[model samples]
Target chain A: MGVFGHKTVSMTAKIRLYVDHPLGDGQTVPLDRDQAHYLFGVMRQQEGADVALFNGRDGEWLAQVTQAGKRGGELTCVRQTRPLQMPPDLWLLFAPIKKARTDFIVEKAAEMGAAKIIPVQTEYTNSERIRQDRLQAHAVEAAEQCGGTYVPEVTDLQRLDRLLADWPSTRRLMFCDEAEAGAARALGAAPRGPWAILIGPEGGFSVTERAKLHGLPFAHVVSLGPRILRADTAAVAALTVWQQALGDWDGPQSD
Target chain B: MGVFGHKTVSMTAKIRLYVDHPLGDGQTVPLDRDQAHYLFGVMRQQEGADVALFNGRDGEWLAQVTQAGKRGGELTCVRQTRPLQMPPDLWLLFAPIKKARTDFIVEKAAEMGAAKIIPVQTEYTNSERIRQDRLQAHAVEAAEQCGGTYVPEVTDLQRLDRLLADWPSTRRLMFCDEAEAGAARALGAAPRGPWAILIGPEGGFSVTERAKLHGLPFAHVVSLGPRILRADTAAVAALTVWQQALGDWDGPQSD
Candidate 1:
């Protein structure tokens, strides 16, 4: 929890912050054990030191530590630094891969403007064990690194069959079907509605999975390219393709 | 060498081969020490045993072990098995990243259908040290894993300036500009040509680098999406976009 627990704050390129709430009349905000360790032990924030703070919905604000300790720390929230970060409306749905590659996928997914990251287990998937906390933590860090206001939600891994069984009516699924030849131009040209890009696993979607996906009226079986791509590569590729084709551009689009 | 040295052959399905050639064919196709060790010690093939061989351009052939030792190993090329695996004609050009990510980039690049993998040193590139041979081996292994006939050649790290200075006349540079808003259609609508997808490193292109690249007549600045992609992600994303766009799309057309 050392570096991982650093509070996401809003500050200028170079600015100090205090965390005592202005509404609370300079009363120091209590730092949890994990947060205290991170600030004092890891980040080495001392008393009267400045740091940034931001609630997900609220604009970023500066804070300063009034008390420092190994196990306990306190800070005071001060003036505002910057406005809250607004994220794009992109959702990424990908078949899960191995643990390490899966983590990598989740991390990149969050950093890449995905409002939601959904994991679908396809027919060919072998490994099923997943630590949701680990994946969610990776997403949080990735969001912070990219300076995004919204952290993409890491939904539990669900079977493709079940997820598609009750597929949403409003959200269009840009199914990245490698088996689908070069019919992408036609499908891509007419894309509409809220979109999510679906990438298969390394072994690729089973014939049944592909067919199930094909039957969906909302599904756009988009192709990644001429050559076969690894599942993780396909995920990133599909996201890029979908973003260009229908994702929010220049931050948030009119949609 | 243990797992990678075995020349994995891909048939439409499983193949049964016969090895019959003059024991000594006066071929200087020397097996490296590693290959010899794997063939003689690891594989434990006898003096007369059937093995498969394919040299990308050359048709697949059956080869029999005539000599077996760690220092020297020889096999006589016999009857043909099947035609060689012809890979798609696509090249991947990416600026170097940290070592692990760079290796990941090369491995995934080969597995994903890159005919050639070139690592370029960009203006913001922090990695100056690269082992060409080691990286090349990674490409070979990736090809083997994906059952690809053509092992992409991982060229020595070339300066971006030097590479553009002598850019190929016929090859279309599909520049994957991260700052680009988005591709018209990721890969789907990418213009056709002898294509190369260029991915910049983490810190991104310097002003000078960007200007030089933009000035190139053959460069087509395309986007992956709205997000700020990492270097490795950008490489795969760019390649995917290229594959979708001008690649071998034999799908049903809109018309």
Candidate 2:
């Protein structure tokens, strides 16, 4: 159905929308006030306008704007356009740094195809507490902006020791170490399975933390070049390296 | 020799410096007012304080503060520390986006080891003009912060057609195409040679521009992943893929 009182018509242009509600043919998806403002007020989308919707569950779907209002709106599902293409089972674990840098890490992690985002508190971690909900919102925004159907879950702050205690033996960990500065280990050689990339804080890992990580059989320490990258950059670089090396970047179903 | 009036001392911490002046053993480097303030007022480094310095042409050097002043200062080279490690013979050509994002492209390019940075103007490019000097300064700052000895030159904005008209056949171009959303080409398979990564503006490339790029014999089109990354994130992701695939990230001398 065409918006603005026009007849129903097919559209090719993709206007991606990430909805928290379920999606299926003929299902009505409600939008919050902000989303309504964005769709109706900012983007000027009108009722009956075709919109792509993903609920991080049902794949991507073509939908029609059923009700457009200033305070709220609704989108009725039409048909599936693309399957729910989930990112690889790769997780990103890092120590929270400054507020902006931490947000940058989360945003980049979401954009770079991290399946999960975990903030770890280490001995040398500077930030004592993190606004987990805010960071998760940034991830959602990033996923929404990146045209990603799947949104990585950003978990609340967890202690490194506690998390490592239950570390999955089958999942290999790419430990980015500062001490191994010049050792540009080719991460491609590592076998791919469940994996996680662990990046430390700006001050780097403490001696005890380093020893524990090094002692882990699942940890494969890797260096991100010789230069010391800031925490945020390291997160992006590490994610890129991991994705290129063993993640879904080489797969045919990337898009 | 060490700073703060110390005798010959052993220092393990690497404090990188980027000076406009040439650097060599016994050579003197004069600091500007800002640098003087950073060293004296901020860092509180007094006379005889050891500092590492690098010019784009020269290798890194260990130097000791010779003249300490409020407005200006000087450091005399004591010994050669590390050789000038040049990044791969790779260039990054990207359309200028928002101010902060453009700055980010330059900063991450320098950190990820782009040998040259070029801003190209395309039909869909939003920014009418770019501050080349400011972007260049950001590159220099990135190099300094990342402890890189070489700083990539940031060229002024140029027409993409003109650049392609004088294209070097030996240099392979990795054109990041938005249309190839799902075809994640394996960049690792491409032969190593003079290379450049071309990232388009936020609006993406015009059809004519894509046709020109696709028609190039030297162009190797690649996809970052399934997600539609913003221009800035795409730049960093593309650079990481290139570096991990064929750039110096495989070499031992990443630092």
Candidate 3:
């Protein structure tokens, strides 16, 4: 595009951007105001600077910045560095707790390679309504920071009953139950399929909800151990356990 | 000790406290100003109410409040509830990052079952010094919050070289290196023994440091995965991975 072609320096920039626009070879990706400010004003990128772009569809592309301005910038794709590596079809379904912890859950979920993030309203869920846009932004930020090509979608908050009613029989649910503490089974032995990890809120699931979940055929009730983990900690632990056991942690590409 | 015997009602109190004093049958534990304010003023607890107490040595004990005051208070120990279940001999050695992230690391490590927490100074370590006392307090608070009977000690910051020089031959180190990012081997096949998960700083381990670590016979280098995790996220992920692999995650008591 300018001083050096993307093929010449394929592995130069560490800054990876997650864009919504389509990407391909020779395609010029336009930057929004925020991304322009970040690239030009904050990171102080100049013309011909190398940048990596991923649109969650195509593989990561090494792009050369052709124009740099405070209000607008453009980077033309040159070469694909990596294929679109999707995370395992794992879903993180958690009851929203405090605001910061909720943000943390979404961010960590993205980093740990959850395919989708869903907020469910349990009886004990503290937050009645969630800002889906804010959480989705956090997920995008996490993906960008973690160098992940895939960005998990943050679904709007739904009632726990509705979610269970519409639960896919093929998708197994790993129900994190606090009442059944210390009664957890080894996740390593769990059957591999579409899986979702359900973490409860601070006050935990109500008795009626627990009963309904216990009766659900698709729900595989498991405990996080003897310690009383907060909802956020439980989310991370559950994801880690699930990933290590059945997710992409042990996949060939990971190694 | 006052109105109710230790065996009177073991399930009455949900409040748990981490006291600095020894606890035993009929032993009166003194509460400081802060504890007094929290119990009496904040929680509105009255004399003769039951409280659970753990001092990191004895098992958790059910204690009864005997004296109520604005400045000071006392509780008489009744009986032990849960034994002092120690975490595995797994230590978390990490280069300190930002203050809040470091705190998050300590808290998560405790909640996730780390035996010892050590902050090491590496070549690319950003924080030159760490508040050992504050971090240790965080460990305690995490244990308390997670209902852990045993608390992991947060050791003072030690140079990585010095620590490696005096490394115990019995302990195996799971070195998390960014250079070997996608080339990480599975931790499942790692030999079980005294173990420590060493996470580098924000800038990652320097070349010389990585070389030394790779050359060590006791070090088993592993990667977190393809995704680039932050230092704090890496610590939690490493601990979770190790725990799910060789720690007490699959132990009989955990279930």
Q: Which portions of model 1 show Cα errors greater than 4 Å?
A: A1-31, A45-56, A59-68, A72-91, B1-54, B59-91, B169-172, B182-191, B249-255
Q: Residue by residue across B1-255, what tens digits does model 3's lDDT show?
A: 111100112244677789999988899999999999989999899999988899888978899999999999999998888788888888999888878889999998898888899999987786898999999999988876667788999999999999999999999999886445433436778788789989887766666887899999999887676566777777777886777667776563232
DockQ, per model, reads 0.27, 0.30, 0.29
Cα lDDT, all candidates: 0.65, 0.80, 0.80
lDDT of 1 by residue, A1-255 (tens): 111101112244223222223323354578778778878888777888876654445555557788998888777767755565555556787767777788888977875567788887777666686677788878876665554545678888888788878877887888766556665655547645677778776665666777777889887776655444566766676676665556564345665
Model 2 residue pairs with clashes: A1-A8, B2-B48, B3-B48, B3-B49, B3-B50, B4-B48, B4-B49
Ranking by TM-score: 3, 2, 1
Best by DockQ: 2
Which stretch of 10 consecutive residues in model 1 chain A shows the poorest summed lDDT?
Answer: A1-10
Taking the candidates one at a time, how many backbone clashes does each contain?
A: 20, 7, 1
Q: Give the per-residue lDDT of model 3 (tens digit) for A25-135.
A: 799999988999999899888999888899888988999999888888899999998898898888999988778889999998998889999999988676899999999
lDDT of 1 by residue, B152-237 (tens): 78899898899888888888788766456644444445456577878777766777888888889988887655555567776766
Residue A192 lDDT, candidate 3, scale 0-100: 87
Task: Please write out the lDDT profile of model 2 over residues B13-51, one tens digit for every residue.
Answer: 345678999888689899999999988899989998888
- Between candidates 1 and 3, the one scoring higher on lDDT is 3
Q: Give the winner by TM-score: 1 or 3.
A: 3
Candidate 3's DockQ is 0.29
